[model samples]
Target chain A: MSNASTRNRGIPNPLAWIGAAALGLFGEIGRLAVFSARVKAAAFSPRWYIGQIWKQIVQIGFFSLPVVGMSAIFIGAALALNIYQGSGRFGAEQFVPNIVVLGITRELGATITALMLAGRVSAGISAEIGAMRVTEQIDALESLSASPYRYLYAPRFLAALIALPLLVLVADIIGVMGGWAVSVFGLGFDSTVYLRNTLDFVTRNDILTGLIKAVVFGAVIALMGCYQGDRSKAGATGVGRAATLSMVGAAVLVLASNYIMSTIFVEVGL
Target chain B: MTTPILSLQNVEKRFGKNHVLRGVTLDVAPGESLVVIGGSGSGKSVMLKNALGLMTPDSGKILFNGEDVTQAKGKTRARMRERVGMLFQSGALFDSLTVWENVAFRLVNSGVVSRAKAKDRAIETLSKVRLGSDVADLYPAEISGGMQKRVSLARSIISKPDLIFFDEPTTGLDPITADAINDLIIEQVRGLGAATVTITHDMASARKIADEVAMLFEGEIIWRGKASDVDNSGNPYVDQFVHGRAEGPIQPAL
Candidate 1:
């Protein structure tokens, strides 16, 4: 009550709030850059922790296959139905198989697989690492004279970077089959004819472009996870916040990078 | 003069506006047991961390034997850390690694021993801590808190370093278990002939494991002497802390 007479009664100071937000964002970006540099330096050092990398590959790559396959299959089925309906209006329903294969191979398969992994792998990494951080296991590593970045992060990053492209390749094949199933069973097209149409329409460049997108998205997902967890504050609440931020950040970065990469692919005529 | 095994010279550290450590200076002679006793948030951990080179001091130097290792970087830091082990307050055992793997971490991680030999050594170390063969293959999460603490102790002493830091080794255990842990720690340190620095709020633990004790209060070492003299030291803050007083020079943080 004493301070009420001295305070401004009108609107909030938008510029001050906006400026503070901008500064905070810049600080975060700067921290991430330094962390990435340390990762690069650690990469050049000996003792790469290949055992840890293998464990992570099995965890992130092999275990994620079923979920990725399921999503790709559903995406293919949904795309076939949508494309068939739209093409039907133009009396070009015959192009359904061709378009479905082309769509999955060129973009949808890779982007969807990456986004799925951003939720699964990235969030898992942040939570695990953040918990280690708060509990001082990371400090324990330092006490043991080991680099936490090398022992903890490098392996996960390498696994995600390797796993995404492989997963994307798997997604492409499964997605095409899914579209074929929908075309044959749901749309009443002949199975052999639909398969032939997909094969004929799909190109090497389309498959490679999707794989490339997957690799970039993979790095973004793992890097953001490691970054958030590395700088995590104290307590259970802090770990939870780190995991949430890592997942959201990874998903957003994946989507944004997907758009940019797709545009680059188109511009380059790939 | 033979240099002390560890030395902190006027070291200071601040986090944001909070000065956790202020001009801390201390030394541990070879094979000596020095326990730091402080209330929660009294900068005891920060002092130990600075000495271990886990956290750099805002000012002054940390000398290990003779060389300054405040930065804890490169070959010198590595060589220094080779003879150092820290038992964290929370047991801080890597959850992903099994008990044997956790104990043998330093050896396997640094390639000092083959994986096959490390497992055998881990089991041997576990036995020293009075844990049975059944405990080795279990994950940290699969064990009780007491078991986890024992495992952590085993890990710390597995490498048999010359200088060790034990952070609250008996914090959560019951009286019997706490005594058991203190006994285990004593056995390990004596067997290694190591200089020890332990931080705890437990007077019983300090009395049991320490040859000398230091009290961290208001970001400084306010009182220190022979462990036997702690009860009669007479400093109000140390008196309040040692007796677990509700009202004294040391106010509740809230």
Candidate 2:
């Protein structure tokens, strides 16, 4: 009997599958690390592509404002309502303003905004770069000695890095105002009291921590997008898969990193 | 007598169990256009990539201007690359940029010329390809496929590179447009005085642009001769390919 007929081999060997998965994960991680290192190395390299960087900065920073702001406002209002309802059960309704501000400043404002941007900006980056990859534009750049890292990754990475923090800042303000508006009118709480409580409860460190996370999230978003994109296979479906992977991967990293950063902040007495 | 513009010696490349380029050795002289004809998956693209220093051969050497560049890295590789240009199979124009911007890419990126002058030069090059000035402002997505190919051709020559590689110059064009591209390629090669390597299965294109034609089969250059001699080559594989016969050693995929 032939080996193909004799052996069923329907089930994959569990150990082999595990090993392959582990190797594949490590390979992906290694590739990403190498890509990041190159992005850093090209940081101060010549032919800075100042115009491209500026264009990206405007695309990433100014263009992303409204969506991030709108998301923040809605989340803020919802969080205010939730806290008001939950705290009311414990007769601690007065603490709603404080918790809302703290939540917005330290966590939700940054993480939610980053996640939203991951879907919007990161997906956009990946799709655009993936299209370029499938079209062989990246290889074209390499053959021209134009340095894809300097021309493509550097500009977009720097823009996202500079943009996300500004977006987060806008998010934080809009969020606090959202809570304030809900408390002042809808929830029938005093406007001045809510504002005073928000100011008193949130610290500079809280805002700074969120901003720092913004930077990390920004890097993750752009880096994953470019990495997935640069490695995309040729075709529409391949580029589409790359875009999906980039958005999903960047969002997961943002959440994971947010947790880690928050833990470090707590441990460090923030 | 002068050093060949590009040389590949015993170059090998593999993708896992599939060995693509198997000790391929070839050379192209300056002011020559060497068209590499091969069946699909014959590793012609990989061989081009290896010669261009876009991919490292697992072993052997690639020399440009008498300098071994197979292992060239950092500034060395960059310097070698600075003198080389390629037109990708898909034209590969940056979709975000307009036609003029695509043509002026090398000049603008190198900062050798101001953007204003680069655009001027871009229009001038576009005109060389018979592209109208109106096409210059349209994005690559806005242009027809053939126009995109012309724009890609223009971009490749914008830097006046010493060596140029065209990966399937006429793969997806109508016969008329393909012939026009072939003509344009011949003109450009002569006008620029650049060593050229074009990979294609398009026999008409091969015959038109090839000063010398090389046939890549089974990851090796099986036969090479003047373009005019391809039809009379006695090698079975060459005869089969040149004649596009169904009954030969080369099996057409069903």
Candidate 3:
């Protein structure tokens, strides 16, 4: 066949794939539009939005506390044990308290814990929203003139943004407590000394940096969750893909962003 | 004739190698009811999608209110949509919302009424469809298929749209409920003076609600005439489809 006829006769390979991707993306954007329209059309006054916010606070913040706390405690204990063993070989056993404080507060506590939370929250958000989209509820909203984004995504995003930091803060505190427990009990260090050292080792900058990471991680998780879920296609299979992608993608991205943010923070001398 | 509320001029749409719509042209004048009758996969759904701007046509002019609406975008598209309503094949009511909320959706989106007022309007619309106000609080899943269809209908007409499209509106309902819905559709269209275009395989519905009927076969309208002429169109394809015959001009799918 001539090249012109070849081109005219069938779907272009690259164009077909591009068109498929575009259709998927457009479906998501359409969903977002429908979500926003539904909210606008719902006459959900300021009171309704506020109520939604409150609901988010409970769902995102309160419900996440136990997991964040447990994960942080276990991580802190494991780090302390590892540091104590390494320091002992160097005849630097006394350095265990300082290393525990520095490691848990400076990097591991917020970064690792936030990564876990991102996987949990993002996967949940994506699955819930993806299922809703797959089932035609989103279309119903559009037919009714409601915007799905404002109705569905906005409140969830806000909840994650607000609740995640609080969860991280709890995790940070519990993590320090875990480190203290190990330093005092396993290492046979004086409780008072370990407490003083932890207090002295932790700078205001360390806490602030962790909180900032928490906030950034929260936004990333929410964005990925909403994007993947809202854009899902092909029913259950699509929803399953959305949930998996949201979790795995959020976990990887959160860790990667933590490293980048940490580098920027150190370079800026903050 | 009063200006056609909707007009499709040589509209065409194709999906990959499959041509769904082949230079289809039709019109719905003000307050008129036009039904496009065809078998499954005959491009009836695609035609409605094209008119609704859900699917972009490869070529054609769709004039709404005498203005080219084929490629209207942003605010213009939104405004055009605000005056139009659609009933999807599956009722497609939001499972998360109550019946009243679904019915009140367009009214709320118009940003012209308070929530209290919108709810009241929704309830009134529901009542018009013979659904009690008590049904308004029920989720879509809580209702029977017929009731859900009624709620869907209520949602469609609540906006009092100038143009409406019904996709297989009576498809899943039993004979009695389907007839009731068809009558309600006719009553509402007449009452609101809104132009309507319905696509269906149901000849009885076409006869009841259509002022004019067009038969779509193999991506083209093979017959077009007044509703009364459907049975006597003398077109083999139309006869086959209307009678649900197995063997005719439309070969069975292999």
Per-model TM-score versus the true fold: 0.96, 0.97, 0.83
Q: How many clashes would you count in candidate 2?
A: 0
Answer with 1 or 3, whichever has the higher TM-score.
Answer: 1
What are the per-residue Cα lDDT tens digits for candidate 1 across B87-129? 9999999998999999999999889799999999999999999
**How well docked is model 3, in DockQ terms?**
0.37
Q: Give lDDT: candidate 1, residue A134.
A: 88
Candidate 1 structure quality by residue, lDDT tens digits, A45-128: 777999988999999999999999999999999999999999999899999998998899988999899889988988889988
Which candidate ranks first by DockQ, i.e. highest? Answer: 1
Q: In every candidate, what fraction of the native interface contacts is reproduced?
A: 0.90, 0.90, 0.42
Whole-structure CA lDDT of model 3: 0.82
Clashing pairs in 1: none
Query: What does candidate 2's lDDT look like per residue over B13-61, in tens digits?
Result: 9999998988899999998889999899999999988887778999988
User: Which has the better lDDT: candidate 1, or candidate 3?
Assistant: 1
Which portions of model 2 miss their true places by more than 4 Å?
Answer: A1-8, A44-47
Off by over 4 Å in 3: A1-57, A93-98, A185-191
iRMSD of all candidate structures: 0.6, 1.1, 2.2
